[model samples]
Structures are given as C-alpha cells and as structure tokens.
Target: MKNILQEVFETLRDFLSVNSPEQSHMLTVYANLDQANPLNRKERPAWLIELKNTFDNLSEEQKNALMTFDGASLTWNGIEEQIISTLEQHEAKGRSVVVFTDLSDTVVIDLPLPVKTGVYYGIPQVKHMLSQLHRYGQYLVVLFSEREHRTVFVDVPTLVSEGTLQSSLGEGIFLRPGGNKTRTQASERRNLDTERRMLREAAGEINDYFMDEPLFDRIVFGGNLKIAHGVKNNLHHAVAEQLVSIEPIPFDATDEQLRETVSILADEYEAVHDLALIQELILRGETCGRAASGMDEVMDALQNGQVRKLYLPYPMDADDFDTLLIEAVLENVEVELVHGIAAETLREMGGVGAALYYVIR
Candidate 1:
C-alpha cells in the first residue's frame, strides 16, 4: 500500500507538471469497480453505467474539445471502448479504478481503497483520489521484558507487522556466594543493574534501527510497565517524543494478540489526537489565532501557503471541497481526512478547517 501511494504521488506530480495549452481538455475518470453481485457476471456494472451517463451529460463543445484536442487521437466512442476493454482485461477485484488521459496518454490505476466515483473534465480531480490513497503513518511497537525484548514495526492503517527485532538478555547469574545476607543483597543489586543495562542496550538498538529507516510515526511500548518506562527514558529525545502509549501485554503474547493490543491502543491514541486537533481549531478560530475555520478563511490561508495542516471530512461530495483539497495538496500542505467527532465538528465549521503557520494580520 505504501508503494502504491508513492506511485500515485509520482503520478500526481507528473500530471501537475504538464504545461501544454491543450491540457485543459484532459479527462479524468474515477469509477468504483466493486461488483454488487458475483453471480450475475453478465450484468453491466453500475459504475460503467454512471460513466456513460457522465459522458452523455457533457456539453457538445466540451465533448468535441476532449475528442479533437491536439495530440489526442481517440474519439469519445473510442475512449469508452478502450476503458471497457482495459477493465475487461483486468480482474474486477479492486475497490476503484482511476483513469487519467489527455486523450493521447492514458494511465489507469486500480486502487485498493474506494474513491469518489465521477468524471472530472477540464482539470484532473485528484484531491479526493489522493486522500483515499493516503496511508496513515507507521507505528513502532516495542515489547520489553526482563529476559527478552522485541521491537515490531507496524503499518498503522492496516495494523500489519512489517518486521521485528529481538534480543535475549542473558540469565542473571550471581558471581558471589548467596549464603550470607550482605552477599545476597549485593547479588540482587548486581542483577538489577544487569537488567537495567540490558534494557538500555535494547533502547540503543531501537534508536539505531530507526536511524536507518525513520518512517514510524508513533511508538507503543508493551510488556513490563517499569521496564518499558525505563527503556522509554533511555530512548533518543526525538524517538521518545513519539511514544504514545504503554500497553499491558505479556512478553509471551502471540502475534495475533500483539497486533490486537497495538490496534486498540493506536485507535485510542488517534481518537484523542483528532479531538485535540478539533478543539485547537475551535479555540483558535474563536480567539482569532493562527487558525482558520470554514471554507473562505481556510481557502484564503491555503492560497497564501500559510496553512500547515488542512482538515476535511471524509467522503465529502461537494465540488468546492474537492477544489480546496486540490489546493491543499498542490501546496504540499498536510491533509487529514478526519472522522467521527472531529469530522462532525469540522462539518459544523463548513466542512473544512486549517492550522496556519501564521496569521496574515
């Protein structure tokens, strides 16, 4: 999924770079490919019907411009036939299919996630498509124990473990005689020191691991709480700041159990994060701070490149929302498709808001 998103980003970049005067006639189509009935294989899919209807609805001038644009050889009928042929050749398994063409060059992308189904003529409506393709940041789950410690890298959106690092702390052996009380106390202290040393080393290993691939957005610690906290304190400041939660998972938990624990904690963290963002936006808007709520102010902030983060409700149907999203992406602003309470609050604020870098005033 990450690789697929990277490809989509690259495609978007290429599309944005085109400078031809005839580029205005480019047609981009987004279609939901999920079939409603598996048994009725011969039935025409609903999305295909919608696509045909969209073509039929376009003005004659618009239709002619698309078909007869310079460098474009395919007519409207030829374009539809090619779309059908290409779709037929591929298995109808993905959630959506996106077609981008200047009528000369066509790029079809079969996405794992669903996107808004429609025809976007004149300009490529890519904001919604990119938003759907966006994957949340990765997670680093570290399970610490007295005897063994493990670090599991997780893809937060899918809750799938990418890989793991593990190390065994050697047995706590007392070198001195334990028969005497003083010697026994000293032995216990030495064992504690050994455990702390092992944990510190494990923390160092984690730092090194992420230094090579620093993609994880959040960190979760599990197993022994005391040990986890100790390791957390030992981590680098940058990595330590990413520590979101510490869960009560057993050191010997199965893969499934670990994944479930991480998922639950991650979801909780996200909910809190979303709520906080919404609250900040509300407060800033009321106080006239570096925040903009509602479409007008947010769009103005986005145009000036002052928006640091743009928040929008998922699955918004309005064309204006699409335009705002496109502007946000083109400016390299962080776009978050909020949901639940955050989305509801945003909808009340005209379905969009932004955290700005600075207020123009």
Candidate 2:
C-alpha cells in the first residue's frame, strides 16, 4: 500500500492539474478534526462553526460566485451540507481534513498528521498541506540481527508501515568442536568471515531495494548494534548517505516496539536536522552567502527564484507565513516546518528563512 506521504504527493499533483480560472471561486478548508470531542458527538465541531462564520462574512460577490458556480445544480447551502455529511461519516477523529472545491470538483483528504487549522476561501491554499507532507516524509527502517534482518518502510508522522522490503535469514555459522587450540582459532576465524559475508549480502539487498524503490527520505538502522553498524559499513554510498541513526533496539522486538523506537528516533533526528538547517542559515547569512533570514529577505529570495529551500516554524502565527509559504511552493522550493528548539530559534529570526541557490550581491 502507498504511504500517506506518497498519497499526499499524488493528491497535490492531481489538485494542481485541475483547471482553475482566475475568476473561479474556490473553498479550501483545513480543519483540525483531532480536536473534536468524540464523547460529545451531538455538538457541532468547532471547525464547522468556523466555516459557517467564514461563509457568512464573505462578500455578496464571493457568495454568489460560489452559489452559482454549479449553474443550478448545487448551491452554497448544498456544498456546505455535503461538507458536513462527508466529515460526519469519516473516522477522522485524530487527524486533519482538507476540503478543496472549485464548486465544480470537490476533493476531500484526510491527513494523518496535524496542521495549522484554518478556512481559506480563495484560491486553494496548498502551502500548509505541502509543509505538513514535507515534515512527515517517508522513511525506511532496517532492523539487523545475526539470524535474520528485516526492512520496513514507514510513514514518519503516522507510524504506518508502508511495506516490508526484505525479511530473511542469513547463512548460519555454528561453532565447531575443535580438538586443539589451532583448530579452535581457525574455526573462530571462519565464523568471523561468515558473519562479514552475511553482513555484506544484507547491505547489497538493502541497496538493491532502495534502487528499485527510492522514495525514502531517510533510512535508519536498528536492532543488534554490532550487526547494524557492520551492514552500514558495507552499504553503497548512495544508500549510506541517507542513514540517520543506528538505534539500540533488540533483534526480537515486536512490531509495536519497533514503531515506537523509530518514532522517537525520527523526532530526534528531525530536531537535529532542523537545528542544523538553522545553523547553516545563520552562518551563511553572517558571511553574506546563499542564505536569507527574516520575512522580507526570504520573500525577496523566493521571488527571485534563488531559494533552494524554505524553513518555517510549526504553528506559525505570523500573518505573512502563508504568503511566504505559497511563494516558496510556487517556486518549487523545498519547505521544512521546523519544531522544538529550532522552531524557537527560527521564531526569533522572524519565523522564516530560506537557503538560496546563490548569493545575491
């Protein structure tokens, strides 16, 4: 099955493909369904109420445009009813839902990860959607052991297992009964060689799997630290470069345990990743290199198509955050929604930054 990240990418592609004219009216609702009280099913969701208020506040022109977009088939009320009914039926209690409609085609998506919730009643606002997707990118976990090794692909935010690429035992190397010290030493040497050979084979299999399916943003190794490191050493440079961490999980860990371990590791890795990016931005900015910090500089860089990547804090409160995000996405700049200490640091630095393709003199 395709992971949530893959599904989001496909959805984004499809959404962008739909023809949307300048005069077309679009309703984009990003609601945090996870905040709904499951116990109080009778109460209207906060998001629905917010949407109602937003709709009420729209100008007559906007309302008329939306109501008449379907040409007598669907009205504004009908569209609202559909949204309510669809959301009511779906089991999206702990997730965010995005509703995009040009009044002709309506697409609803349930996001496995949480996002900054709001109702955008203009052109489809895909910045938050794309940012969330980037934050919870796809990853691979390789759990190595002496007897067997397993490879599992996971969606980082949801901890949902996409699929297992490999799960097989290696050649067994048993200790031999040696009569003399010389024979015992020889047997030990043979066992070591066999182990190395098994590790090399495992690394080759992993490299091949990555080559065939290269959607993984990060790769982690867990279980049997010795074997994990051994396999890491033998991995091809392309695969090795993506390795984030070698965790100390047991070889016989249950699926739940494995997921939990990887989840924590992924978060830590992301925190470190965010910090490194922020540091890079700061260092480059200091030296007048290819980096821009603060809203104005970042926006200028994005407009110039000089931005290679944009970094913003999660739960951005800045009024221009979405505008910056939209510009970055339109420019095909990589977006990273930072959290934790890095996010705090970014907020201090005007809550937005970008790594540019080149320094602007």
Candidate 3:
C-alpha cells in the first residue's frame, strides 16, 4: 500500500506541468484529497488537516483568508507560539506534517514525529528547501495522502520510498517459480533421501557399508522436508550419532538462495563432520593386483609432497608425522587435524578426509 502511494507521488512529481490538470498548491491539495478518495466513497470523504503556523508574515487579514473551509484544521498556531502544538496534533494521529515552506533557519525539535515527508509548494520552493535542508543537515519530511486510508511520508532530498523500507524491514521468503528441470531435480533428491533412509533402517547394510571404509568425510541428504528428516534421524540412529546434516531444499527456491543454503550446509558439515568415506570392496576387494588399504597406498602420494591437505586425527602426535608434515608444507599442502567431539563422532562416521568445499568449475 505504501509502495503504491510512493509510485503515485513519483509519477506526479516526474510529470507535473502547466498542462497537467493538477496545478497550484491549493489545487494540488484538492487533487491529493481526490486521489486519497479515488473511489469517491461518500462515507469516507478525505479530510485535509492543514496545520498552519501563521507568523507576522501573514497579517491577520491573510491568515483569515486561509480559514475558508479548506478542510478540517487539525491545529493552527500563531507564529509567536511554538510549532510544538501542531506537532502534538500530528503525533496524536500518527501522521507527519508536510511543511509548506522550506524556511532556511528551520529548527530541529525532538518531537515524536520520527518519519518526515516534506513538500515544497513548487519547483522554486522545492529547490530552495532542498538547499536549505542540506545546509541544516537535518532530516526533512513531507506527507502525501496517497490513498484515502494511506498517507506516505517522504523526505524531499533523500526521496526515500517509504514502502520500500517497510518491505525490506522483514525477511521475505520469495518462492521462485518452478523451472523446466525442477521435477527431475526434486526426484533425484527424493531418491537420495530414500537411499539414506533405507541404509539407516537396515542396520546390517549400514554396518556393512561402513565396516571397511578408511574414513568418511560428510554425508549430505537433500530432499523435501519429510524425506530429509527421515534420513537425518536414520543416520543418527545408525551411527549412534549424527552422521549427516539434513538440508531441505525447497522446490521453488531461487538459484541464489539455493547456492547460499548449500554453502552454509557445506561450512557446517566441514566444521562438524569429517568429509572422508570408507568403503570396503568385498566383491571386488582385490582389483588390479592390489589389496585395499588406508594411508599405506596413499603413502607415496604423501611422501612425494603431492598431498594438498592431510586430515589427521586430532590426538595423533604431530611429531610422529613431522617429516611428512614438513614435506606437505613444502608442497603447499593444508593439513587439517580433526579433534574433540567432532574427531570422535566424525571418525566413527569417517573422520578428517572430508571435502571442505566444492567448486562447480
């Protein structure tokens, strides 16, 4: 609603001209009232509560001229009296005042009117007020009765859209429209979730899967809410601890939102779980005349200093592997030593040899 009001104001300001039906400040006021009551609802006739601070600039005669049934007078004050009276009436109604003139020597009061919208009568006044407001470096406010029920306060120089601010105030969940590949993607997530659930429910399969694995890094379950939760619970029960983090990807999530969620999940998994997986190839254990073994086969890669990173047990003495560590450092390898509760739990799930970050390219 506030946004619609701002759009109207912007349109009015951008295209106001002599040919335009809305002219003269007084006419603008009437137009604003009509605009506020666009539907011409007889019951809700819009009222313009004009607050006038008539100083000596307006003689008693001119001041009287302003009182000709323009609208309901919210409050009127003598120049001698402080503007606080008008401010009070405005605050009572939760509305902001649109100061007509951009008086150069404007004063700032801590009156409760937090949001301000200021309007100069026309371009000359607008330019002058803008300059004067700039000199004072104070927030200027003016009110626009956009619709009968809505009033928007916009700062002159800043030209901030009140509606935009309101919209941005809350965390908005924008559901993206489904894409051509959405069904396929959703189906895959469902299948992966089902697989994890089945493995966990069948404890024998779960144990068999992990029995001979050297280490496992991270287990990611992606699916809808129900399947995701099922996989998560099953993995927890199977491993006697949480083995996977359940990331429920919404079917209608934007690419950017999905990317952000995936990044966050990856970071959490890396911090808490080891990205290593151990798989015992019972059916094809001896392949290419080599028996499956951990660390020993990869030892040459570790020695040649080709290892980019070493995920070692937290409690393992660095001194015992200092030579390999130095070689790794020389080869610019990152050695992450997994420790504490994460070490104990993730090791059972498959410890330090985990994928930290994945790059699509």
Candidate 4:
C-alpha cells in the first residue's frame, strides 16, 4: 500500500517548504509496520518504546510530546483498509503528526538501495529516495497524440494521468468528394499538417520537462503509432536521444491493458537503459579515466567519495556486496544494477566498478 507513496512524497515536498526546528525536542519515529512483521504492528513497537524511553531523559516538552503520542494509533491510521504497509511518523509540539507510507521500500533506513530516512523536521531527507529510485530506472512514458500528453512513470503506472499535458490544434478539416477531389485532397493535407503540428508541439512540451531535470532520462512512446512516430521524428534532440522504445499501448488503452503494456515495455526499456549505461561507462572509463572497475578499486574510490557512479554487474548475495551498498549510500554515490552483457562486462572487472570524481587524463 505504501499508502499511495506519491501522496506521501508530495506531502514531504510541502513540509520541506516551511522552516521547522532541526531538533525541536520533537519525538520522531519510523515504524516499518510491515504486515509480515508482527513485532512492528504490535501495540508498542520495540523501536517506539525504546525511543519513548530515550525521551524521558530529555526536557519535559519532549517527554510530554512523546507521552501524548499514541504509538499504536500511528500504526493503525489507515491500517484497517490495509492502506499502510510501511509507516513513518514525524511529530513535533504544536505541529501535526506527519506520516508517509509506500508500497515499496522508499527509504534507506530499512532497505539497502542507497535511500535515506531522517526524523528531523524541515529537512528534505527524501533526496536519497529521489536520486536512487531513478538510478534503478524511472521511465517517462510519453503517450503522444494531438489532444494531450499522457506521461507516466513505468514503476508507478496508476499515476500516469497526473503530470499529463493537454493541447489542441483545433478540429481538422475532413475531406470528402468526387468533383471536389482537388479541394478534398488539399483539405486532407491541411488536416494532416494540423495533426503533425499538434504532435510536435506536444513533443516540445515533453522535451521541456527533461530540460528542467524531470530526472527521468529515458523515454518510451505510447498511443497512435503514426502520431507517436511523428512526435519522435520531430522531438527536440535532447528528448530524441533518450527515446528507448515505443510501448504497445494505444492512447485509449484501459488501466488493466496499460499495466500489461507497461510490463513488457518496461522490460525493453531496462535493457536499453542498461546497455546505454554500460557503453557510456566503458567509453568514459577509457577516454576519461574517471571510471574504476574491479572490487578493490571501486571500494577504495567509494571510501574516498570519488565514485561519481557505481555499477554493480548483478545483485550480489554475499555480505561484501551489502557492505558495498551500505558504503555507497553513506557516500551518496550513484549505483546502477545492471544485467546481461552489462553484468558480464562488470564481472570481467571483478564484479564492481565506479566512475570516479577525477580522470587520469
């Protein structure tokens, strides 16, 4: 349920806008509340109890806040509908209790994916979530048409309609006739021109998003092939360069159908993204001397905060891999989980590699 992570994410953005105390003697806690973990759901989670005990040593204001907060109440908010799988609450005196949930591990506190969690109010701790989630891959699926731009992130398909853009080229002239065939053909030409114009204008709007760092570097086309292709053809070079593939979904595709379409298209997009990253890593490693391959070199670079990017050929099951992942997050390093030939390439370099802060050249 992540209880609709997007809502939590949006709330976090709004909360960050105001200045709250760094350590306002506020009592903050992150309760996993994973249904599978009973301990987390109990009346008093051990973590919360321990935190409560710690507050007793602080000033009366902190103690009062912690004492008044019904820890179980926090866990049960939206729990009846199974809306919350993981819950995090940030509380302060004279401030409302703020909670965020996600269907996936959006925080590094519990997961090893370089995500971060902080109890301090007014701090944007979600930077870790924002940066790492996209690194794994977040696609900007552009469903192009003359009417509107239906953009979606592959991972979160339901929210596709949110950032959508709308535009119109006015109604196109319809062609019909025998004696007026010449006029009809001209009308047809005009209509197609209008269609093309609308598609390109939509593409330009989509391109504007990337320029502003939508952070979704990969693009997949959806909707009518004719219009989608036209948009692809006319896309600003920046957007065109990142076009991965086209999704087999019509503009009017239903939610269920779009979900299925996204599944297949997402797989293809990942392959494309991984291949592109691998090629870039190799070319840059050789040309710029900024990338390091092999475990020892990568770890050394990570320890020094020189690893601009990290490439793990495949998911490692060993302790060492976990250690590396932990170090990467602590250092705020960018990591990509690669597969297939990309994995093979990294394996050739001792199963790990890093793009560093400096180039030997």
Candidate 5:
C-alpha cells in the first residue's frame, strides 16, 4: 500500500490544473506540506486515501482544460507573464480562457487588448471592507490614471464611552455617551450635554425594569445607533461588575451578517455562562473551607435548591465528579464546565458577560 501522504502529493502533481491564466492564480502549492497535514499519519489513512482518490479520478477533459500554479512560490512577475501569455494565445486561437484555483493568493489580473479581467476570491484587501456586497443599479468601474494602482479606503469609527442615567420611576436606568459632544461653543455643549443626560435617563428606566432579581436571560438594545450606545453604557454601569455586552446594530448590516454575529454571540454567552457558574461554585467551596463552624450552611443551601447553577472544574476525579453531578441532577440544578473566563468575563461583565447570568440574588 502506498503511503497516503505520498499518494496525495502524486495525485495533486498529476491532476492539478495550470493550463489557464485564472487557474494559475488559484494554485497555492506549498513547499512545507507537513504544515497542511492536519491529522496524525496513522489515524488519518482513510481520510488521506479518500482525499487523494477524489482528486486523482478527475475526468481527462477536466484535467486537460484546467490550469494550476503555486501561490506559495509564484512571483508577481511570473503571475503577470502567465496571465498575459495565456490570454494572447487563447484569444488568437479563437477561444476564451477561464481560471480556477482552490487556494487564493493571486491579488489582481489585467487583461490584454479588448479582453476583460475579473478577480474571484474570498474577499478583497480594501480597508473598511463592507460586511456585504452592495446592490446598486449598475456596477461602476471608475479608472484612475495613477500608475501605482493606489488602494481606496473608507473611514469607520469605534464607539467608546461611559456614563449612567436614572429614571424617575426608580427601577429604570440608562447610560449616556461619554466625552464632549464637540469642540464648539457653550450653546452646542449645553445642548449635547442635556441630550446625553436625557438619553441616559431613558435607558436607565428601561434597564430598571430588568434589574429585578432573576431577570430574563438577556436584555438587548437594538435600533438607533446613538441611542443603542447610550443604552449599552447605562446597562453596563447599572450591572456594575456582573456581566454585559454591547452589540452595535448597524443600520446597513445585512441579515446574513446579523445572523453570523448572533451565532458568535450565542456561543460566547454559553461559554461565559459556564465559567461564571463554575467560579461561583469554587467560591462556595472556598467559603465553606473558611467557615469557622458551619459547613452545614453551605450544605443546607445546596439541599434547599438555593444554588441556581453549578460549575464543575475540568479534569476532576471522575468518580467524585460523577457522584456530585448525579446529586445536582436530582436537585434540578444546572451544571457547566469552565474553560477560560477572560473573554466571557468581558462580555458578561458588560453585555459580553450580560448574555450569561449569575444573578447572585
């Protein structure tokens, strides 16, 4: 039996395409193949063989028509030459050429004469990369005479501020934007300051209703960028050192981008929720250890269903851990395994940590 790694190398070397200019850009042949090997040689035989065979069995027509090149080593000069030559030869022969490559390192391509050039890659390197491709009436391709092909850029500002507001009803609270509104005169300053205070107060009132013990899993502030920022800040202050996260709801963010962001936040929340529950459990154990007279108090709390969530440290003595876990299950308490708390702490402590809860009530 041939070694799977060697088989894959041979397969790629054989079936790989490098016939067209576009396909040349796709090839990203690596010299240090060991780095790309994701699995142990012994355990990965089946996978290696399957992968090797999949590429090895390509149709002859596909193989012959395909073009391949190495992104890892192909120089900029080589890229230009290959693309230009391929275009000239194919165009003169009365055939259009298209390229394909799995690995993308080729930056751009310029066609000769009347031929058109288009780059298809994961994403472009333009600064302030848009979350989604914009849909407009017609695609514009404005050319500049600058020989250097200067990159275009856009400005994006990050929001960072802190302050608090309270509602007249007492339970509601809000946080307004921090820092001066602008470097203008007294009238403008007064107006901005007053607006900030008002926004904070409104946010405070909304948050007040949420501060009751055993509040809901999360309180999300979405809509109106400025107002959302204020709400996030106020909630952070009100929650203090607990946990919270501020997610900016972009006016232009698409459904897909929003969905991806939500998914990421959910994963983060689960992690934080687990860590906080575990930290509390550790604290309970420490408190029990330090107590002069009564471990019975801690036991009583556990027995009476006072523990809302339980955090079990990783790599515990299996037998003891199972026993405790079973007992907690019987009591209907939630359990989690703590990994790292830093990121979760940041999230939940603000809205980041806010996604998870410890209530401590």
Candidate 6:
C-alpha cells in the first residue's frame, strides 16, 4: 500500500514538473466526487453529474479538441469511469482530471485539495506539492550515543531508516578500573575526553553524510539533551542552522521507534514552520514591503514571474485566484496552502502574499 502511494507520488511529481507546449483543450476538472466511506457510495455524486454537464456544455471547439470530433473515440462516460476508478485505487480524497490530447498519457492525480478546477492554454498549472513535498524527505535525524550514532531519514508519505554509525573512540576495556588511584583518575579523564571526541567525530560523520547529499531542511538530534548539544556544537554551521529539535531515544532504536519519533517531530516542525512563514509574511508586508499581496498585486507578480513563494489561505473560495495560482506554479513559484492562524494572517494581507524573486518596480 505504501509502495502504491509512493508510486502515485512519483507519478504526480513527474506530471507537476512537465511543461508541455502542445496546445488545444487539455481538460482539467478537479472535483471531490466520491464518498469518504465505502458504505456511503450511494448513487452517482453531484460533482460527477456536474462534471458531465460541464463537458456537455463546453463549446463545440473545446469538446471536439478534448474528446475528439463527434466524440465516438473517447466518450465522457468512459473517461468519467476511468477517473473515478483510478482515484479510488489511491484512496483519493479529491479528483484531478488532466485529460490531454495525448490520451495514452492522460491521468488523474489523487491529490487531496478541495475541488477547485480550471483549464489554461499551456501546461496545466503544476503545483508540484510544494509544501507537502518540502515537508517530506527534509528530515535528518541522528540518535547520538557514546557507543554509536544511529541515523534515519523520516519523510512524508513514507518513513525511512538510514541506519547507523558506531563509535571507535576507545575500543575494548579502556575504562577498566585497576592500578593506582591517580592512574585510574587520569585514565578516567582520558576516557571522558575520548567520549567527547567520539561525539565530535559523530557530528563530523553526520556532516559528511550530507556533504554529497541534499542538505536536510530540518535536523533532529535524538539522544540525551546534553550529549546531543555537545554533538550539535561540532556540526557545520550550515547544518547546525537547520536543526529543529533534540529528542531522546535509545542508542539502537527500533525502526518503529524511529518512525514514531520522526512522525511526531515532523508534525511539530510543520506546525512551527507554517506559523513562522505566516508571521514572516505579515511582518514583511507591514515593514519591509516585499510581500506582494492582495489578489491584484499577487496576480501581477505572478504574471511578471516575480513571485518566488506564494502563500494562499486554504479552504479559500479560490475561483478568483485559481488561474493566477496556476500561472505562479508554472512559473516555478512555490505555493503554500496555509490554514488556521495562517489563514487569518492571509485575511489581513488581502488573502494572498508572495515572496518576490525581484521587485516589479
């Protein structure tokens, strides 16, 4: 099941990155047309009916371009069934209909956004799950210990264990108590130094782990607070800055334990992240004046390709900004769907904001 979801995620990602130039009507119908509970699958959904009506009402040109002239080759009935069945397989909460002229490559993505659909001339606005994907695969967790250092990569839609690194600080009976008290004390001091060195070495190992790989957006140290801090101090400043939280776990944590820890931390990190970005948007809008806000300003920024990150309040009546949202996405802008306090923040900023790639002055 996890593998299936992963595969879906990969497919969605590929579609999101695609910037196809082939023109003509590429029908996009995003609708929530299924019951959440299987038992409630009573009758055809209103959205499906509405979707069919939508197609039926399309201008002759749009209809012909979408399903072909006279509509014999690909009927709406068959396409609707295909969309529903595909979405159901992925436990999709919402429907995304991307039926291109190239029917063989047509697909329905099971992204769980509230149904708000639109169609544009060029590439369908590919959001690429900017926030969700960013949240996932961005954690680098290390469980530090004097004996060994264990690490795992916990990410979205899936949790992954990255394995471990055992310490070689003082191998075999280095702390055996014997001989004179002074000698014992001196050896004890040496052992303590060795322990610190081992931790430092662990930090270096962690740093090296990310040198060739993409740097994690968040780093979590999973061990004793003091020891985690000690190891943290040795981390490269760039990596150090990405640190999220310190959590205590066993030196050799089970995969389940690591997964649980990662899940909890990931949730907490996203919460803080949403709040921080919202506050920053509000703050910047008020003071620095960099946040391009309001429907008009945001739309203009998007069209001018100035928006680097776009913040839109979730559960919004997105009909007004849907086209602009797609334009921003196709322009490679990062789009975030913020809710709760963040949603209220957007209300003050005219319901949208953008971090500009460059001021449009």
Highest TM-score: which candidate? 1
User: Between 3 and 6, whose lDDT is larger?
Assistant: 6
Q: Return the TM-score for each candidate structure.
A: 0.73, 0.72, 0.21, 0.55, 0.30, 0.63
lDDT of 4 by residue, 152-246 (tens): 66543323433554434343211222365447667777766766666666667777776665546467787756667877888898779888777
Q: Point to the candidate with the largest lDDT.
A: 1
Candidate models: Cα lDDT each: 0.71, 0.71, 0.33, 0.53, 0.34, 0.60
Task: Please report, as a residue range, the 10-residue window in candidate 2 with the lowest summed lDDT.
Answer: 167-176
What's the best-to-worst order under TM-score? 1, 2, 6, 4, 5, 3
Task: Residues 192-242, candidate 1: write the lDDT tens digits.
Answer: 787677667778887877665655678888877877877788899887877
Superior by lDDT: candidate 1 or candidate 3: 1
Q: Give per-residue CA lDDT, model 2, range 50-96, as digits (tens).
A: 65776677777766666665465567788678766766676774468
Which portions of model 5 miss their true places by more than 4 Å? Answer: 1-186, 208-215, 220-227, 236-243, 276-309, 312-361
What's the CA error at residue 117 for candidate 4, in Å?
13
Candidate 3's TM-score = 0.21
Give candidate 4's whole-model lDDT: 0.53
**Prediction RMSDs, each to the true structure:** 5.7, 5.7, 28.0, 11.0, 22.7, 7.8
* Model 2 ranges off by over 4 Å: 1-25, 30-75, 78-97, 104-119, 131-139, 151-154, 160-189, 317-319
Give the 10-residue window scoring lowest on summed lDDT in candidate 4: 90-99
Which candidate model has the greater TM-score, 3 or 4? 4
TM-score of 5: 0.30
Q: Which residue segments of model 1 deviate by more than 4 Å?
A: 1-11, 19-24, 29-73, 80-99, 105-122, 157-159, 166-189
User: Per-residue lDDT tens digits of candidate 5, residues 64-158?
Assistant: 33333332554434544454344333322111122323433222221111112233222111111101111010101111110111111111111
With a 3 Å backbone cut-off (N, CA, C), the pairs that clash in candidate 4 are 2-101, 2-102, 2-103, 108-115
Model 6 over residues 1-361: C-alpha lDDT tens digits?
2233345445544554462423423445555544663433656655555555665666656654555622448775665566556544544444333332234455665543334443332334344333223333457777755444566876643657575444444331122234666676677877778767766776777777765456355688876566788878888998788788887777677878877877777667666777799888767767767778899999888878778788877556555664565565456565677756777877787888888766655
